[model samples]
Target: MANLDAPATAIIGCGNINRGDDGAGPAVIARLAAEDLPSDVELLDAGTDGMAVMYRARGAQQLIVIDAREPEGKPGAIYEVPGDVLAAEPVHGVGLHAFRWDNALFVGRKIFGDDFPSDVQVYLIEAQTLDYATELSGPVVAAVEKVAAKIAARLVIAPEA
Candidate 1:
């Protein structure tokens, strides 16, 4: 259970490291984990688990999600999307593996209500490939550093009431 009285920011990364660029999210989380972030911020490497994303985000004052987007002509392009714009209701009957962070966003709001953070930001990195591999493409590696630095900078800012 989350402590409703404690105000915190949740940063969740979702992805499959086994798939080439799909590992961007976890990569970012790994980088942030080594940095000195604010005490009020909680970082999670959800690793393709939407349920974990929702549970981890509970009671957070803000939520930031990082993931890789499917290839669409460009590689390593970063898109900062508002959560509401990407949030989708979970489809009934789908297995847990099919559930995604976007679905978690909708379900979390419905389940947690005011306990869930309304300030949600999603950063998507366009992938060059989703093939079975351990190394990230050159462009993705650069983008990961940029995204990690950007998130770290954002965490330093004081939260608004």
Candidate 2:
């Protein structure tokens, strides 16, 4: 069960760490874990589990998600997109394992209504590769630091509503 006194903000990272740059999300979470964030902020290493992302985000005033995207010629490129712009309904016949963070945004809003955070942000880091590996590529490693710093900076002054 979710705590009644949930954190004011939830930051979720989604990706598969074994697949090279796909690990960018969790990598950022790792970086943030060492920081001194406010108690009203929560950091989650969702690691490709959309259900976890959806349930964890409930009752928070804000949600921030980080993930890696397929190669687009520019590895390490960062794109900040509004959650509403990326949210999409899950396909009807797909298994839960196939569910994604975008689907979580759509379903979470429908199920949780106002309890779900309205201030949602998604950060996508362009990938250099998704091959089997345990480490992020050189460029992605740099982007992880930048994104982590950016999120940490935001949390410093973020309202505890």
| The best candidate in terms of lDDT | 2
Clashes of each: 0, 0
> What is the Cα-based TM-score of model 1?
0.91
lDDT tens digits, residues 82-101, model 2?
99998776558447868888
- Screening candidate 2 with a backbone cut-off below 3 angstroms (N, C-alpha, C), the clashing residue pairs are none
The lDDT of each candidate is 0.90, 0.92
TM per prediction: 0.91, 0.93
Q: Judged by lDDT against the true structure, how good is candidate 2?
A: 0.92
Sum up the clashes in candidate 1.
Answer: 0
Error of 1 at 160 (Å): 15
